[model samples]
Target: MIFNHFHDAYLYTLAEVYHKPQFYNQPRGNRSREVLNYTYGIESPIERICYVPERKTNIIFNFAEALWYLSGSNNLDFIHYYASNMSKYSADGRTLTGTAYGPKLFAYGDKRLNQWERIKEVLREDPDSKRAFLSIFDASEVLQLENIDVSCTIGLQFFIREGQLYMSSYMRANDAYRGMLSDVFSFTFLQELMATELGIEVGKYYHNVASVHIYETDYVQTKTVLSKAKQIGTVPAYPFPPMPLKDNRSDLQVVFEYEQQLRQGTITLKPVDIDRLDIDDYWKQVILLFAVYQSIQQKKVIDHTLYQKLIPLYQMLVQQKWESYFSIIMEEM
Candidate 1:
């Protein structure tokens, strides 16, 4: 597609430069007026670089890797490269499930769904809850990952305004062009699903990939993509209709009552947002709590293993001054 907006423009620039950068180096008089060429050309007397990447090649690989996997097409050689770098892949870490390395990465975005569930709960309670959010921006966890030479964020963020859900994924770096497509579609799906459950409309999608870097390799194609994003296109409607709730009570009287409501087709799930409660202060505690819960479910038995997971949660709660919440959870455990 032709780029119509800055976002698409940025992405196309990255892919083009990274994939095949030679075509874009042709100087447009070296006047520094053409931002794309002036910035991308290296050691070529270009004065200013508008979008210099923080971790140049890693950003390219980061976006490219996601794109490659999602395409469900394999670059067998690259897969071998990833596999060969086994020492760099953190096999021992808190991933959702399954094998280590790239296999686990494919699922990193999926676990963000846990946050989606909480946000949905909040919206159901009070649609205006400014507290609605979920973030996968876990620094310690990201740091522990061995294969993190590539600068990137481990967490993504989600928020809601009025009845609309908004998401901003914070990346330490990104190959903007290729990654944006997947990021947009995936988060949009999350927004639409949550909106349907809450009886609200999906609104704006705000994406922030901290560094939208176009490498020297993809300069030409990036320009092509920029032109594409600039053109207007209809935002596609979400696929599903509003999902209905089902009751599964086993007690005879309860079952009868539930069935009666089901037959009448009048039962509605009330959605609420609890954000106004000023629970933002407790966000770290909440996320860590969930993480700890996940760790426990993994059958971790060693005291140190348990302590490693719990200590961070403990420290985070202390830092947030939510000692009471921490104490309550500890007592319950």
Candidate 2:
């Protein structure tokens, strides 16, 4: 089924998947949970896509993870800051293994083939090419490992049809409650980015998950979200701004540099810092949001002016009736 926004699709999946009683043993062998094979399509994946009402969905971490993947980074220190639990997923305690989609997508193996760049080149050369696909799963390592972090996503295929860029993501598995929202956020952001680079309108996003399951541990939270879903009306689609004219790669590099400095405690994020970047206003706000999040994490006083500037964007979260989630940061400020 197709939905206008990711939140509706996710809640619908939770409501349906929770009823399936088919329990299966997880690969780690430590847990057995209910599982179901599910597939759904998102018509407007980038519009009204952030699912902050779940409480478990960390907006800052989601953005950070997307940036991390786009930057082709595998540094544990960088990712671990956004999600501390990511440290647990590290195989060598320094970098992520099979689950590092960045390395696999941008620089796979010793040959270091930049799959994303190649896909862009393919699309540029032949817009109708069916070979413009980005692969994430590394079978060579995943097939042998029973206890490692294997990629849940198999690959993503892009199609340029009718002057629009459409994306189809194939996933081997999806944790409906805990992982699906973030996955959609990251992938669709990439889709929009590609559409921008291709100088076309963003088209439909088709998500196919082989196994969409909610673990027994997340049952209570899932039920809470489902109940909330019933009380809330459908969220209106966000009025997404047009893609900026500036090169996104350059903007991403600037953001990555600031992020690194922030992590190293070498630079404190300030209002002037936002002006220094050549990125679009929206992305500058996103970068500022990250800086605010870091301040909140450290119990430091936030810049009230910057916080006020973010109010309009925060109002989007409130419009979705996710004000409580946004209040977490507001309370600190």
Candidate 3:
């Protein structure tokens, strides 16, 4: 979205909105080395590719469609499974498990209202407030799912600037081109819906995925997405309208019921083609990475545990004496 520096744009979006202090209370450096990406140098997946062959807009939309299929479909199942697994509540907020039905509660209103409702509320509270923030950082829900197989949503963070909503998601892992593309599309749609609900005009929809690397095995799919992205010229815009709430109910039961009908006997989600992602537009992402790397280095206050692994790398990059060209490569990356 109209950024002075791509890195600035990316870091701002990645800012933490709601950090659960409990999760942050872990022992420092307990698992720092396990988190570092030292063996994987700058030339790894984090580096920017100069060229790709896909249409930008098509790639963005393809990812959007995939996200729609996932959110509208599996999200409810994730909620149900999580709720059933814990199935208990706690008197103290400290030990509150799934009994409170947080997953089921969050699934209501087509899964849009629960996620974007607070965003709209922030907008309505101050139509011109540039600092409107909201996030989906339900650790308890995610932990329950993690106990079984894998968690769905690692965490989400959103920010509003100049009437536009920007989002950033942090995950323990992602599917490079595929996951990043889908994430961008879904968050952009969510931004549009929140804007519509708040009665405000939509602006830019900025998005970022912290880890844009590839596994040794997924290189083939990753290369295909990159090649396709270079082929695409422009990114597609997803038009997501605001969801209608039934009598202002915040509970997720109604949403789950609707999902039940959508998923009759089998849950065959529409597959998102890897070719739909445009790699050329990802240049901005490369720019943002440099910026984040810089921020991590110059950061005087290092209080958060989430960024512990990045500190050493940040220190090394800062010593390189990188220059203004950092911003120029954004368009080329």
How does each model score on TM-score? 0.39, 0.89, 0.40
State the lDDT of candidate 1 residue by residue for 281-317, as single tens digits: 2222222333333233233321222233333424332
Minimum summed lDDT over a 10-residue window in model 2 is located at 315-324
**Candidate 1 all-Cα RMSD:** 21.5
All predictions: root-mean-square deviation over Cα? Answer: 21.5, 3.1, 18.2
lDDT of 3: 0.34
Whole-structure CA lDDT of model 1: 0.36
- Ranking of models by TM-score: 2, 3, 1
Instruction: Give one digit per residue, the lDDT tens place, for model 3 in 49-159.
Output: 112222122222232233333343433333332133322223232333332223322353345445445555665676655444443334545453233333333454555
lDDT of 2 by residue, 63-120 (tens): 7888889888888888898778888878789998766788988898889999988999
Query: How accurate locally, in lDDT, is each candidate?
Result: 0.36, 0.75, 0.34
Task: Give the C-alpha miss distance for residue 205 in model 2, angstroms.
Answer: 0.5
- State the TM-score for model 2: 0.89
Model 2 lDDT, full chain set:
0.75
